[model samples]
Target: MSLTLEQRLDTLPAGAEVAWCGQQYVTAGQLRADVATLAGWLAAHPARHWALCLDDAYAFTVALLACGMAGCVAVLPGHRRPAGLEEQAPYIEALLVDGDWSSAVLSFPVCHWQAVMAAPLSAAPTTPWPAPLSVLMFTSGSTGVPQAILKQERELLAEVEIQAGLWADALAGAVILATVSQQHIYGLLFRILLPLRLGLPLAAATCTTPEQLQAAVRGLMRPWALISSPAFLEHLDPDLSCPGARWLVSSGGPLSASGAALSQRCLGLSPVELYGSSETGGIAWRQQHGSDWMLLPGLTLSVDAAETWWLTSPFLPAGQRWALSDRLVWQENGFRLLGRADRVIKLAEKRISLDEVERRLRAVPWIAEAAVVPLEIGGRRCLGAVLIPSAEGWRLHATLGEGRLLLQLRQALRPWLEPVALPRRLRCLSAMPVNSQGKRPYAVLKELFDVAIEC
Candidate 1:
């Protein structure tokens, strides 16, 4: 039998390849040494919770394992912006970063990851992580605030086991390449833990562009599996050929039918789409667009009188039933998702709360009232904002013109929102379109952006 991740960490041979960093491969020996050294540094620190914001996947894996080894809770904030980190400062004691962040103004002590990795090796032996290890992750809540979700080590391991059991055969002898960030749960599982648990080599850097992905695949000369998102898969050039790819997994949002067909033509494989949320681990998966989603092994689904979905799984805390905002219809073989019952939407594979965007917009001094709606622009989904500006805002808009006024609003929102969550188009309206029931309908709000004079 193959060794589990914990056993492999302790028993893998020194020369075994672990990851591809830059032009060369990082070996098991170096990974162990670096992890040990960093773990020692972390152990010596007084912090109990360390936030990981590294861009390099290799550095992120090293920091993550070291945190586990050192008995600290790892917090992934999903974004590396100073403002985002500041919002998480109350929960985290220190920050672990890889790249140069000299200009970022932060309130917490920063740990330069490269310097610690350069330190002399420690002789400490790797041991099994303590039971019930936890990680803190933040996701946008329906109430327009970032909600913290705690995931136990066992839960993550169970998810890894389920995925490995289902797809390991197809992915055997294949290296992993990804176009997603490790900060999210899906990326953390597929790009990092799954490969580590399966002993498959993973690329240390994320391939953000089609050219980068092509180059990485061509250089590998071996079968590869792509861990990607709907946003990245949608943008892939149909003519771009990736010859050695064997498996492709898409998550974070629903993949359009056209996007799935495009992946089949470009990568020679239809993407296996995963459906779930941070609050719940993976729920179901399907390969064909519009097909019913098959539940993963060991999960039960229940629906309430109002059609809200509830999930009970071993991966959840204590196997308790968790409520979900999605409504589903049961089919003979599986379930079909109707749609979400909340205002939250996925933009560029990032979970965004429309309420949160409106909240931030209303907080701006020049904005009196704000409404946000999802818009599809140039084959991509994004946000559009309709603002009922204050007197001062209207004055500025008249003086600065719509272009400059929109720029100012975007700049004001940069500190609170991710780049992908920011509104791509803006319009200033005298009054919000509301129905007789005093509720703003989504159709009316979306129609405001249909005019040609959008800012």
Candidate 2:
């Protein structure tokens, strides 16, 4: 039997540790009190839509749960920039933030953490568990504009239940630590929902760098489960001690066989990779030694004539089937993911749109024309950009030298693009590569980057 969010909350003893902030332990009682207090404030203000933009993991978690209890839709944006916030301002009533943004003025009102904490606590609202409240997740948009994927409380709760059962024995009595941000779907599910629902202690700070991660779990005596991504797992220091971890889980992108083997040698456990998307909760997962993925319980899978995978899961809306962007081959137990059917590719575990990167490059004032392609380098995928320089670009290149000019343009584009979307391999061309038929030749354009690209 599955437990509802409300029931799970009730199961945790008030004194049970819920989170560890540095050396301090935050109890379940404290978390509940905070949630109740925030929910009360949200109820009194009564905003139909609220944007959560907190950098602190614990604060973000409280705001998320409070909004659900108050029955207001919570909008989580991938970027915290002013322009990005402005794009969501029309859809949200106000922004909830724990970060400093006092200098910049924004369209919507901002609600700081201090204000929320001072509000009086009310009895936990009568709203039932697994309430009808909705959460809108905006993707990082490696391809183009961020797309919103709507999720209901039930979908989140159900996913937690399914994952809990799948790893019940492995996760029993283990504390949860993570390197991923709670802002994304995988992080939310693995780091927040799973632990909270199962009454496990969670770490407050996300381990962004390997050193931080090593430090966090250094002296911990309790068994731990790490929820991380392929990019982070690829770089773990084998010399470091990760003594208490029972298992390390990777998602957000496929973990290469070598990465998995390296993680096992260094960390003493091979990562369990989950293959899924924000659109469809979690489809399948596999360990490093396995060639095929095994479907989680309660998921139905099919393939169309075009080889695109289709899914109907408990987390998805009833009677609605989702068509995935990846092509797959069906097996009796699960399926084998072949590759993506779309132009989107994963770079450093983040889905990047080649087309979107090209568009942003073309929009750069110094670039007259741009073409972007994905290239594998040193066992990882990265983007390569070929550009036709505008008049301004030519002048800068001649004056500042190629390296300096490239650095300047890269910095300028950071505001409009993500770090992953910025091309690490760039080349400036005299003209577009074309054939006798007057059509651009993709083979030549791709080969230019593989060989020597003339600036």
Candidate 3:
């Protein structure tokens, strides 16, 4: 049996490299020492809950381990925006940061890792974390306010077991380089815990841009695995080449087949996309070559009357099951995702799928991109569309007024959709509002119709 992460960390060889930041390398001894010092400091100043808000992945790992050591719950927010942090401040007693906090105005006590590292180090503490030690993770549900998801120590360990075994040979001896934020669950597992447990080196800094990614890939001459998201993979420069990569993983959103093919051409391996939510750890995975997603090991899946998936997995507590948002159809070996349940809404006493509306709209000529949303106008719920038009769409919009263009779109959509499903309000924009995770910001998209628009 594999040892638990905390136990594995205690046995790691001191001289082995744990992380690389630029040209500098951090060894296991250095990491252990930092974690020890932080744990010591945290032990002295106790809190019920601490927020780990570091931007640096390496620093965040140390802080997280220290929190575990000190028996304090760490709240990992989806983003570090001042407004967001302000909302989360009530739950946290203090904040741990290694990034810029200048813009964030918080009432909670703030402590930096530098202070902890600079503090006198006590003998390394070796207390195993409690089985029920809970960590809080926030996810931006379509409703907008972040929803907190609790993850216990057991669930995390189970995930490590499943993921480590799944990619053992592919990631054996290879370092981890990631473009995704470690604050998210997927990144936390792939970029930090997996490497830490397996004793593989990880890159300290997150590659935020394509240039940084290229530089990091080139800088690490050894074989490496990349943890990324569709947002990053979809925009990969075709000319950019990194040949030594053993594997690439994407999560948080879907990657187009064309995007995956282009990435496979540039990188040596095609990206493997993992599908899951913050509430339920990783549920399934798929590669670009396949259309269906294979459930992670030890997971039992079933579909409800509405076709929504319900899963029972080791990642969940005993005798517990999770209902997923995705609608899927089971195959012999795996499942194919249809769409999200939340994307369906009721309009005029009829069920309508927002995805279906967008699909039919995109099928029309000159429509480059389409997002259909239900909006409330003068106390009535109606369909609204935000579009990114092709060159021809722009020409027509310019020739015909906005009202006329919308009428033409409605006429085109009438064949596929009922009058109630057709968009009552339409707006054209150059681009949609996308978050760092590469998902369309539905709340922001809805706001376009919420306010008065002349066009």
Candidate 4:
């Protein structure tokens, strides 16, 4: 039987390897010692909320655990930019970071990773932590402004236990490596918490490029599992070789069929795609062979009259049912996801689904990927599209120029789309503007039409 996170923390051998950081292995003893030192410092301070902005996964884990130990709330911002961090200053009283941040830019007290670790070691505490610790994480800001979501320790542990039980066989003796940032919930759970609870050694650095992933994989001598997203998986180099790689997990957004095939061909396995949000810990997951998503254990699902999905899970507060923005088609054991309910917009008194418009645009032979956003031009609301052109599409664009290419695209969409529903402005590019989480921010997409209002 798998042990609880608290039990594992107390029982794991001190000499066991916990993480690989800065080209060296970090032992369990070091983790405990560091946590003790930091927790002591935090206990002495008066701050209630500390914002963690660390870049290294190992450092982030240490700070998080230390916050729990000291009875403090840990706040994780979605972005590392100064402006973004500044916006969170009003909510947090202190900032903990592993990178070099200037004091002139931030308003709160700053704690450097090096300085904290340099302090003398304090004895590890014997008493158990408070029953339920608190953590603050933000949404991806893909659809609108990012919103804060508060999670309790018990809720996160529940999801971790479910995942550990589901993927135990594949993860046994496998090292955890990730290309995603630990700032977000998906990476926080898969890359940090799961590995720790399962007693798996994790790589500290995030692989931001194909070369980095190849290097990390080659350096590992034992089996490894990669926690990644569609943003990094779609651009993998087919020529690169990855040995000792046993499992691949993709989340944050859906992976395309071609991207899944590429992963299977390169990594010698298909990625298990997870579907959920920060608001709801993991709801369902699917493999490349199927389109339906099976719910995780201990979760119940239902749909309302408007076809909106609702979830009841152990991860939520007792007797609370959470409404989801996603539209789904129910099956006996699982369900298929439609688009988001919020993606529907009204233009010229006609309701148009942006997802449907993007799907129609992708069906064109020339367009490879498409995103549609509501745009306001000259005080009139209309639709604008950002497209990544395929090889043939680019060739035609070069030969016939933008005007003719756009005319052909409009003709292609005319069969299924109403005149008012068609995109009023179009911008073709080589790639879509996706973040590290593999989601395109709606505000950023709206800015694509900022320069020319009438385009």
Q: Rate the local accuracy (lDDT) of all candidates.
A: 0.87, 0.78, 0.79, 0.80
Any runs in candidate 1 off by more than 4 Å, and if so which?
1-5, 121-132
Q: Write the per-residue lDDT of candidate 4 for residues 32-82, one digit (tens) a residue.
A: 878777887888889979999888999988888888888889999756656
Q: Candidate 3: misplaced stretches above 4 Å?
A: 121-133, 142-144, 343-455
Write candidate 1's Cα lDDT for 261-349 as tens digits: 88999999999999999989899999999889999999989887877788999789884898988878899989988888898888777
Task: Tell me, by TM-score, which candidate is best.
Answer: 1
For residue 48, model 2's alpha carbon misses the true position, in angstroms, by 3.2
Tell me which of candidates 1 and 3 scores higher on TM-score.
1
Weakest 10 consecutive residues of candidate 3 by summed lDDT? 344-353
For 1-455, candidate 3 gives per-residue lDDT tens digits of 65765677679999998998779889999887888777777777867688888888888888887777777787887565554577677678888887566654578787776776766778446766654456898754544344577888778878988898989899988889998878878888899989987889999898877788788878888888989877677778888887788888988766777669877877868888998877788999988646789989899888677766789998887889988877788778688887776765545433466777787788888999998878877755788899999999999989996788888888887645657778888888999889999999989888887553422
After superposing candidate 4 on the true structure, give the runs of residues whose Cα lies further than 4 Å from its correct spot: 1-4, 102-104, 121-125, 140-145, 343-455
Over 4 Å off in model 2, which ranges? 1-3, 99-102, 118-131, 140-143, 331-333, 434-441, 450-455
Q: How big is the positional error of residue 450 in model 2, measured in Å on the Cα after superposition?
A: 4.2
Question: Regarding lDDT, does 2 or 3 come out ahead?
Answer: 3
In Å, residue 54's CA in model 1 sits off its true spot by 1.4
Per-prediction TM-score: 0.95, 0.90, 0.76, 0.76
Judge candidate 4 against the unseen true structure and give its global Cα lDDT, from 0 to 1: 0.80
Please give the RMSD to the true structure for each candidate, in Å: 2.0, 2.9, 11.3, 11.6
Of the two candidates 1 and 2, the one with more favorable TM-score, higher being better, is 1
